[model samples]
Target: MTNSHEKLRMMMIIALFAALIGIFSQLIIPLPLVPITGQTLAIGLAATILGARYGTYSVILYLFIGATGVPVYAQMTGGLGKLFGPTGGFLFSFVISAFIIGFILEKTRFNISMAFVANIVGMIINLTIGTIWLKLFASLTWEAAFLGGFAPFIIGGIIKAFLAAWIGILIRSRLESAKMLPKKATIS
Candidate 1:
């Protein structure tokens, strides 16, 4: 493909992933400090497939939509309030985590184990930032923040990470076989 065609394809994929993130955000299991949502899973999938730059762009696009009062966040909430709210840090972490996950996948040979590890690291980053934000925003003690934000979501996070890795690798393998993945691009 020409440069323009490749750029267009990447942009389209980014938009698709951003839309998927918005849709996934609605699948929420409300909790005390934070909600369990499919957003992370979508982030992982997008990152693993789109690579670092495009993956981060996808997250940015999603955030932009949410910030514009699109009702794209959990519980159908959106706007600047949601972006600056208690769960905002976790939401923001998606950008970093997706970039990290995509970077790792692009640098390393694609495998379930590598993807699992990358996802775990990404989850840890998200949880750490989210816990700190919860404490600050809610004015809770560290223990309280851990309990409310990190503790409750540990099991679910692990499950989601594994699922993300497994599914992402599977899809990536298929795409590779079909020669749909760009060889010169960062995607792996």
Candidate 2:
């Protein structure tokens, strides 16, 4: 493909993953303070496949869409109000988590093992930021944040991490073989 074609393809893929994140965001398990959602899993997959720059772009696109009242967030809610709401930290953290996950894979190797580690780290980032945001935004105690935001998601986070690693590696390898993705990641 020409340089322009490659850039267009990458942009299309980024938009697709942004849409994927929105679709996954609807997969919610409701809770009191915050809900468990598949947004993180999709974020992990995007990072593992797209690398740092493109993956982060996808996340930013997702957030921007949701912030614009697209109903792309968890529970099919959107607008800046939701983006800055108590649960908004998780949404905001997706950008950082996606970048870090992709950066880790780009720095190391794009294997399942590395992906798992990256996903785990990403999960922790989400939990930490989301918990702090929940506490501050909701005016809750630290213990309440730990209980509502951090504790409830631990087991689910582990499971999602493992799944993202396994599934992401498989999809990435397949895409590389099909020439949908380059053999190695790139910044541009």
Please give the distance, in angstroms, between residue 188's alpha carbon in candidate 1 and its true position after superposition: 12
lDDT of 1 by residue, 2-70 (tens): 878877877887899999999998898988668899999999888877778788999999999999999
Give the true-structure RMSD of model 1.
Answer: 1.5
Q: Residue-wise lDDT of candidate 2 within 12-109, one digit each (tens)?
A: 99999999999998999999888889999999999988888889999999999988999999889999999898888988999999999999998888
Quantify all predictions' global Cα lDDT against the true fold: 0.87, 0.92
Task: State residue 77's C-alpha deviation in candidate 1, in Å.
Answer: 1.1
List of clashing residue pairs for candidate 2:
none
Collision count of model 2:
0
Model 1's TM-score against the true structure: 0.95
- How many clashes (backbone N, Cα, C below 3 Å) per candidate? 0, 0
Candidate number with greatest lDDT? 2
